[model samples]
Target: MVRVLFAGTPEAAVPSLRKLAHDTEHFDVVAVLTRPDAPAGRGRKLMPSPVKQAALELGLPVMECDPSEETFLAALKATGAEAGAVVAYGRLLKEPVLDALPLGWYNLHFSLLPQWRGAAPVQRAIWAGESLTGASVFRIIKGMDEGPVLAQSTVEIGAHENAGELLERLAQDGANLLAASLQGMAEGQIQPVEQPQGAYEVAAKITHDDARMHFNVPAFALDRQIRACTPNPGAWCQLHEAADALEPIQLHVAKAVVAGADDESAPHGLKPGELKVTKHHVWVGTATDALELLVVKAQGKKQMGAAEWARGAHLTEGAFCD
Candidate 1:
């Protein structure tokens, strides 16, 4: 068996770790490396990372510390691990740590590589209206996701898929790809291929500003942004109306669709951010079209259909949203 060290931190990495742990014939996952526990939830109690929790459930030894720590390096060396597999490990691995393992490291990234090569690939892909996005397994180099690919698996993005939903599907698909890559490498049948020359896009971490909805863009672009930001910072806009003592409310839109010009309620020639409230929909004007909001969550309120919220707020047809 090839002794392996698994390094990862988030829920997205759990499936890969589980795959390695179960495939005992070819891989012996000696230890798991994850970031230290941090405070979470309302009480702010320390919470173990998803990877650490999964490792504990599998009765595997886990090291929750910085990869740069000397103690961590020593413990990792003691594991006699011949190889390492990384999936969404939050921190970068230093040269000394990488040298400790004989077979080096393989990273399972959630993008096609050289495409969305950064921290938030899944979110960026959806936000950019990418119809196809997939996973890649590559050798970990010093550069950021600039490694040679060992294997890759393509997955189609659904028309209305949100970032969270797409990520869940890719995580499992990535696990399967990782397993196949490791098996091929162990058998000496696979070789890493250098990334092709091209101008690739970067997927920087999503900031607070990125989640704010911009109605000035086309309705399709706004729809993509809304889907990408769901279950995270959430796609939000400012409400100008005052209803039920809620003025200038920050509304998080959960679901929306591009409205057809044929809709009679959709105002013609209205400026972007202008709203048209109807009995069954809340349409907002955009640069090229209007977006019909389906689900929305207002400040200090539970998620509800946009029409329901409009009814309760007494929003008129001429109301505007910033």
Candidate 2:
């Protein structure tokens, strides 16, 4: 059996780690490497990484440390592992650690590499309105996600899919690809292919500012932004009332769609961020068209239908959303 070291840190990496640990015919997962435990949850208690927790449940040894540290390198060398597998390990490996494994390292990235090569690939793909995205198993090199691929698989993005949903599916697909790549490598049937020369987009880490909705764009663009930011730093806007006694309310838009311009209920020539409320819908004007909000959550309130929130807030035809 090929003794391999597994390195990863998040929930997305758990399936791949479990596959390697349980598959005894080709691979013997000797040890696991992950980031150190950090505070989490309401009480701020120290919590183990998802990968570490899974390794413990499987009775495998685990090491939690910064990969750039000398002690970590020394402990990794002591594992007697000939190869390494990485899935969202969340840190860069130094030359000494990379050289310790005879077969080198392989990374399971959630993108069709040479594109969306960064931390938030899934979210970026949705925000950019890409219809297709994929998973890749590639050799880990000194550069960031700039490696030769051994295996890959593509999946279509749903028209209204959110980042959380797309990522869950990709995580499972990536695990299967990782297992197949390792099997092919052991049988000497797989070869790494270099990425072609071209201009590719980068997916930088998301920030709080990215979650704020910009009404100046077209309705379709705003809809994509709302989907990309859902179930996390949600897409949000501010509702300004004419009365000074009432404070501006922040609303998280959970679900929305582009509205037809010819609809009789949609008022034309309204400025961006202006709202028109009806019994069934809350329409917000944008640059090119209007967006119909289906679900929303006001600050300090539970999630509800946009029409319900509109009724409770006393919103009429002339209210505006900043």
Estimate every model's Cα lDDT from 0 to 1: 0.89, 0.88
Q: Which residues of candidate 2, in runs, are more than 4 Å off?
A: 241-247, 260-270, 316-318
Please provide, for model 1 over 1-322, each residue's C-alpha lDDT reduced to its tens digit, 9 standing for 90 to 100: 8899999999999999999999989899999989899899879999999999999999999987677776877788899899999999899987888778888899999999989999999999999989999999999888889989999999999999999999999999999899889889878999989998788999998887889987888899999999898878799999876433356889999999887757776666767988878678788889988888999998889999999998998765556787
lDDT of residue 39 for candidate 2? 100
Which number leads on lDDT? 1
lDDT tens digits by residue: candidate 2, 1-322? 7898999998989999988888888899999989999899869999999999999999999987788776877788799998899999999987788888888899998888989999988889999999999999998888888889999999999999998889889989898899889888867899889988788999887787888887898889999999888877789988774424267788899999887757777667767888878888888889988899999999889999999988888865457887
Instruction: Give the runs in model 1 whose Cα sits over 4 Å from its true position.
Output: 242-247, 261-268, 316-318
| TM-scores, one per candidate | 0.94, 0.91
The clash count of every prediction, one per candidate, is 0, 0
